[model samples]
Target chain A: MSEPLLSVRNLTMRFGGLTAVDDVSFDADQGAITAVIGPNGAGKTTLFNCLTGFYRPSSGALHLQAAGHVHRLERMQGHRIARRARVARTFQNIRLFPGMTALENLLIAQHNDLMRASGFTFLGIFGWPGYRRAEAAAVEKARYWLARMGMEERGDDLAGQLPYGAQRRLEIARAMCTEPVLLCLDEPAAGLNPRESAELNQILLLIRREHGCGILLIEHDMSVVMGISDRVVVLEYGRKIAEGTPAEVSRDPNVIRAYLGEEESAA
Target chain B: MTVPAMLRDAGLAALVALALALPVVGIRTVDTGAVLGLDYRFGWVAIAVGIVFGGRLTALLLYDRLPRGPRRIRTKGLAGRSRTLVRYAAVAFIVFAAALPQLPFSDRYVVDTATQVLIYVMLGWGLNVVVGLAGLLDLGYVAFYAVGAYSYALLAKNFGLSFWECLPLAGAFAAFFGILLGFPVLRLRGDYLAIVTLGFGEMIRILLINWTTLTGGPNGLTSIPRPDFFGLAFTRSPAAGETAFHEFFGLAFSTQHRITFLYYLILILALVTGWAVERMRRLPVGRAWEALREDEIACQSLGINRTTTKLTAFAIGASFGGFAGSFFATRQGFISPESFTFIESATILAIVVLGGMGSQVGVVLAATVLVLLPEVFRDLAHYRMMVFGLAMVLIMVWRPTGFVTQRTPTVRLSDFTPDPGAAR
Candidate 1:
């Protein structure tokens, strides 16, 4: 088989004397959904942060293979990770530019492409032909994504004014506009209702099947983690306990104990 | 509320005013030729209390009658109607402004005051870019104005450069200073950024004062050359073979000719500034600025380099300020550090805030109100500033956001319809 899309080796992140993500490593394959499951404070977010260049790992390497080149994400800046490594992420808490329109939020994700076409804004200021063409293409892409999210009618509305569930979906659509090789979503299902979660499942499946990009999702919702994820990596207190297909991981004895707590010997 | 509540509120305000005015205004010291004596002015105090009571009661009644609760969502029809209204108002204002100098009643004083108003309008637009659009609180904007003025003065005095030649140079110099200021305060935001910019303004003023050889200390540079109409001097007599403006135009030499010329020069500059800024708002860089203002972290997440985006705003905003400064130097034929002070920056910032952040027409209206309020109250003598402050307070109370707070989207979907095949 071809090499995995992302390779995280001995990733360790610490704060002072405490190790938040302790030597945890995993590979997320291309065109597949990889769900990272853990209990509270299992260093799930810390690990995501380390992967996205939000935090410097205490020790280890994060290698992303794209365009026939290996990019070390650990050394890059937060923006560089998104720009160069093509790794896009959505925050656990929605971070859309609240005042901007839904379409503009998605357009901003296409900033690098537009910026290059605009000649870093000097040419764009004159509304040059090249810049105008790029902008039209950008608007078209934004329109497509807004349509994909079933939000074509609400593209002009401000992101903040959208209902909570729509805001989550808009955030995902915005990340997709960047055309990332690897998309990291932190609890994309956190506040979603069952219907919305079910809708979100379909969207994720569609993205994997159509876009063929790697997805790294961190979710507490068991239905979402087990329902659609091709692979599940369970972490208990920053240590990986099990890694396998959803059925195998669900059946693992250690995974069940870590989630339910030692089987209660008295019971 | 109810009439009784309004009366009670007004009564409480009146009582507070009376309590405060009794010590400060009701009684005063008088010196006779032989002795100092106390004089009672209870009648004036009563009059003041009565006025306050009546004004507050009226204000409360007016506010009570205004629409309350959630505002109705603006429909496309309503938005289009408002846009048309604004367009009509803008056209009317431009016509009035363009005709002011040529109007039969326009005297030198009238032209000069109008010119002053235009200068503030230009500065207001420039500051609007930084404070309103970029969401960077800059209390040191006048430093760029000062840089532009000094650069023009020094360059013209030392290098013999003409006003037209020095204008862009001055703007570039101010923009350079803007970038210099931009670098240090990059990590800072909001109030901290404001304080640093305030210090940066004072630093420039202090530097001008101490840099005796360069800036001429507190005495300032004088005899700066007046701008000409493309090699034609505005003076009555031509210098050697050079042509005078009146001679070239075959008209009588009047000092009003130069005044009108300067007036039109600034009018053109101000118009160009407004036009360019409006266009820039539609550009990607401008969108980035508004996005940065909305959320910096979101911008970083989207792969936007924060440093360049911010520095571009500062540079562009400062360039306009610099252009205004050079024009000011040419018009006055004299410039000093005294002209560019913290008060100037405050006044410019006030125009931006009062106009409605990021609204071009709003800046024009706010500048007119702020500049005219003081001139209109000149007869108030020592109470002029008090009247001006009161008017500002009234405006703020009436329209907390601004006189015009509508935010038209930079780009609308209707501007470009998507193809049927585009959707995946």
Candidate 2:
């Protein structure tokens, strides 16, 4: 009803001659959770990258009307996409600055704020009250995000030292610190135990309800996806075969044929 | 994040505080000026200057050294803090620097040595941008130095410009050449960049050596005017009333005034150098440089224009080198190709490396040691470089990563704050 917070129109991604993603389009409603599901190499991550400014689409338009402005995602670069579009993302394979502590990782995500804190001078770092205030605010924001992720006690620990599940959560926390309107998660539930997966579901639900944020996740874990996703957009070989409510998509022949186990398809 | 900044800050502060306090606090001055801040007549002066600089630098990084309370500086938050701190620190520096030169001191030579040290420190900071921050190992930083020197000499001789007048022109010309050198080697990196830069340095020197009509060939440029006070040179003049510099101060000018003036000049310059580099580290370009240093791919992924970042690193670095170069030429009232050599680059590189790649304090420490050690070893000048070479090897063997144990992350300080996100 509110013009779908973000709209992707005929998005296609090509790597030289190979087409990784072709003619994919979807509408992500404002403040709704949308799950993009596929097997390995379904171009889910590629699509996420395109949307987040890591890869500029070969052709298509991505528009976002959030916080009172229309932004063309295709027109932005990676950092700008993160900053201007307010699009924050977690990588499929975690990319926390290895040497940095878990908390430092979150702060880096808030880099745009540092630009404001500098006041464009070395002298400004000490003399400018604005810089000091901005610094304190950024620290406050980071603290809020870290605590929300249940990493308050382990903030001093290195990101690499965090357990697999904690690292996954850290990634999400890092992204949230950017204050994004849309949070893109790539296999956030991967490598997590059932308990962790359930915890992750709770976290996502909280993010959706509390922040009113939109989530676009790429997950192969059927239980987690079915358990949490409000809507499922099934991607088969980079093509969307079924898009509907989780139950409806699960019942669709194409989705069952491609994603369900062999016995289920046979039945 | 680089070693030089950290090492310079740490080493300089330690040396300065120790050197000055030791004599007064009864840390007996060992007669020989060869070991432990004891070399040369001005050995203690070198140490005093070293420590003050080091201490200031330490104060800047004090946040990093202190015990980081668990989770207070979260890894997630660290990235933000590291990047932002540089920006904030830079701003504070510029404003405070306005009142610096007026700070009074007793020994004049301490000030002079401090100035020379400051000049080198600036040069080291610039070279750190290329080799330390950008991950470009340039062995030809002196090329910019040569360019600045020649630019100043030729400008003054041809245009009748004053020392102050030639300063900016020297910087601009050096920056122009830095970019010119950068354009052709856009694809090169690491060792290749080093070789190209090495060649660039040699090329400048050779040109200066051969350009007889302009650079005066090997004989060197002479009659170069020294820096003046308004229109008055610091020379002894009957009209000035006082033979001793202190008389004007109502105390006595003595030999110390000359040292005092030169010391303050370079100190201010060094302070400016610190300020400029710190400021640049925060600008969009500065982040690009750090990103480039850490991971070129990520830097590109972030949409940082590498071409601009690399060129700016070069241009900025070269501009500082030029500043030092101009200062050097003016200090001696002479210019020659002999001073601009590959070895000079290597020595400065050693300062950057020994100090810690991107750490400003580290390099200052390295510079203080690298420059003053040899001068202090004036008795063994013949074996000075040999001793220096061995010391470098020893330090590398001991602390291969650098004298400073940790590097400042590219992220800012906010990450250290308790994060509500983590708690949830």
Using lDDT as the measure, which candidate wins? 1
Please give the range of 10 consecutive residues that has the lowest summed lDDT in model 1 chain B.
Answer: B71-80
Instruction: Classify candidate 2 by CAPRI docking class.
Output: incorrect
TM-score of 1: 0.93
Error of 2 at A251 (Å): 3.4
DockQ of 2: 0.13
> In candidate 1, which residue ranges exceed 4 Å CA deviation?
B1-12, B15-43, B53-77, B420-424
Query: What's the C-alpha lDDT at position A12 in model 2?
Result: 93
In model 2, the Cα lDDT at residue B364 comes to: 68
The digit string of per-residue lDDT tens for model 1 on B1-424 reads 8999999999999999899778767888899779988999999899999999999999999998898899665434555467778889878988999999889999998999999999999999999889999999999999999999998988998999998889999999999999999999999999999999999999999999889998988998999988889899989877898999999989999999899999999999999999888877777788888889998877877788889989999999999999999999999998888998899999999999998888889899999899888888889876688779889999998888777788777776667878777555
Give the Cα error of residue B211 in candidate 1, in Å.
1.2
Tens-place lDDT digits, model 2, residues B374-423? 77776874557666766778889877876543556434443344444533
DockQ of each model vs. true complex: 0.65, 0.13
